[model samples]
Target: MPIIIQPAEASHVLPITELVNLFAAENLMLPRTEESVRQTLADWLVAVDPDAQPDDPPILACGALVPLTETLVELRSLAVHPSQQGKGLGGHMVNHLVQMARERGYHQICALTLREQFFVRLGFEPVDRWSISPKVWQACIYCPKFHRCDEVAVIMNLVENPQAAVHPLARPAGWNTLLKWSEWQPLRLAYKQKQAQVQ
Candidate 1:
């Protein structure tokens, strides 16, 4: 059977959500809301089952590329249904997203993921999580495990020329020092202490 890759339609929302949430349940990825998926539908791509009957399922796999900055985009919600795994569907979706990023003139694409090998297999290199833009951490601050984030940052440069240099998030101008996870240990301890005092 042929798998067609195309822009996700409105009907794909539920299947995409269900596929992604399966990984979310295992903490492999973050859970996504249907509303959020709808808002960024344009960024999503889906693989469809070509030979299904009328009442059969429509989408087979899905993924999206979310712009994080003018030159950077984050690949989000990459999910392949259980039945569709190991068939190159995930790689196909990644290739589609990378192509889209290149088309939009993005310099780099990054993913904060536990699946480091998977991203590396797709040409992404491991990078320090602290090297990513601060905007990437905005959502992390609200997460329960903010201080103990386990995801690693992986990045792929889309452009041929080295125009924009990647900046380290912790060393923003006027900041005292470049604080990475290890260096932030004291800060996390202080935060916990402060929270204890408030309680």
Candidate 2:
């Protein structure tokens, strides 16, 4: 059967959600809400089975590119249905997204994943998670394993001489004191209380 890779449609939502959540259940990836998928719909790509039977689903796989900065993006919510694994669907979807990233002028793409070898096979190099950007930490702070994150960071440069375009700012030694979400929880609660009183 022919596989079609294209920008995801509203009809692809449930299949994509199910594939992602399958991995999320094993803690291999983060779970996504339907609303989050809807909002990032434009960034998503789906691979469809062109010859599916009338009752069979059309989508076989899905993934998305999440922008981290002007020159950087992260590959998120990547998954292939269990029945479809080992058939190169994941690689095909990944290559499609990489092509899309380059076409959009993004210099680098990264993934925080447990499957480092899988990404390496696709030309990604391992990097320190901190080396990416603080924006990644925004999501990390919400993760249950923030202090003990186990996911390795894999990076791939789609542009020639990628190092030449590295952002000029020096990478911080560690997360800044102010950026720790835990440090601001009290302030956040207090602000909410004040807003409630005003209302």
Candidate 3:
């Protein structure tokens, strides 16, 4: 089926949440509520089948580009409805987001995804997760999977001579496989404080 991908609007909030939560139910992605979808609707894109009948769901897939810093953005909430998998909708959505990021003047785009190969095929290279420290500090620290996130971080530089463009947040020299103590200390302390308050 042919799909028209465009920025999500007010009408897309409900179906977008439904599509994302469908994958979240299977542990394939994080869940999103209608309110969260609405609040960030400007950052989201949806693919719709223009010819679908009235009874059919209007959204086929969706994703969002969440800004992490002045130069970096993260691809989040990418999902293709089960019925639409294998039709390249996911890649199409990603390409659209990448183009959006570039047009918005972002230096790089990143994603923490289980499907690393898929992103790699689209020119994103695997990067150490900690190198994107702002992302970890902003969202990952609060995630239940913080201690055991299985997703790989991938980045694509959207500039001339992409191969030579260093990652905006390149891992410091001598950085080990694990995160440095100082690097994660604040997040660890904050998590503890959050837990204490919850208790």
Candidate 4:
């Protein structure tokens, strides 16, 4: 199938939500509602058959870049229809999102995913989940799996050599490490408090 990648349209809201929630049903990803998809439609891209009708394109795959901080963005709601899974549609969509991130001036793109190797194969390196503390505070804190998240954090540095710009969580020394460590401490304390409350 010839695939065309483009920004999502208003018509894509339902299909995008359905596609993402399909994986969420399996606990593989977060569920999205039509309203949520509509709100972030501009940040999302959908893969479709170029020959399809404009009013109801079949979304083969979809993903979005969600701004998390000044220099960071999270890759979210990446889903590929079952029929297109092994045909590289997901990878293609991800590459498109990465390019969009670079063009938008984001220093880094990260994702918390169960498919660590999938992102790793695309140049993302595994990092400690706590490394992206903003994500933890903004979303993970409210997740039911906060205390036992099974996902791995993976990052791709868009502006510099990833090796030289290693995330602080993966490095043990330096001021950056100190800052990240300081940031992580309070979160750890908060987690302990939340755990105590739950018990």
List per-prediction Cα lDDT, in the order shown: 0.76, 0.76, 0.79, 0.77
Task: Give model 4's TM-score versus the native structure.
Answer: 0.80
Q: State the lDDT of candidate 3 residue by residue for 56-161, as single tens digits.
A: 8879999999886666778998999888899888999999999999999877788899999999999888877765644445556656676788999888878754
For model 2, state the Cα shift of residue 29 in Å.
0.6
Best candidate, TM-score: 3
* Cα lDDT of model 2 by residue, 20-76, tens digit: 888888877777888888888999999888788977766788999998777788998
Candidate order by TM-score, highest to lowest? Answer: 3, 4, 2, 1
Q: What is the TM-score of each candidate against the true structure?
A: 0.78, 0.79, 0.82, 0.80
Candidate 3: Cα lDDT at 77? 89
- What is the C-alpha lDDT profile of model 1 across 1-199, one tens digit per residue? 8889999989888888888888888767778888878898999999987787787666788899887668878888888888788988899899998998899888888888878999889998777676555556655565556678899888887876434443234444533221122233444544565567579
Candidate 4 lDDT over 43-127, as tens digits, reads 9999999776766447889999998666678998899988788888889999999999999987878889989999989988777
Model 2 residue 193 CA deviation (Å) reads: 20
Q: For candidate 4, give the lDDT of residue 24.
A: 83
**Candidate with the greatest lDDT versus the true structure:** 3
How many clashes in each structure?
0, 0, 0, 0
> Distance (Å) between predicted and true CA of 161, model 1?
2.5
| Stretches of model 2 off by over 4 angstroms after superposition | 163-199
lDDT order, best first, reads 3, 4, 2, 1
What is every candidate's alpha-carbon RMSD to the true fold?
6.9, 6.4, 4.9, 5.4
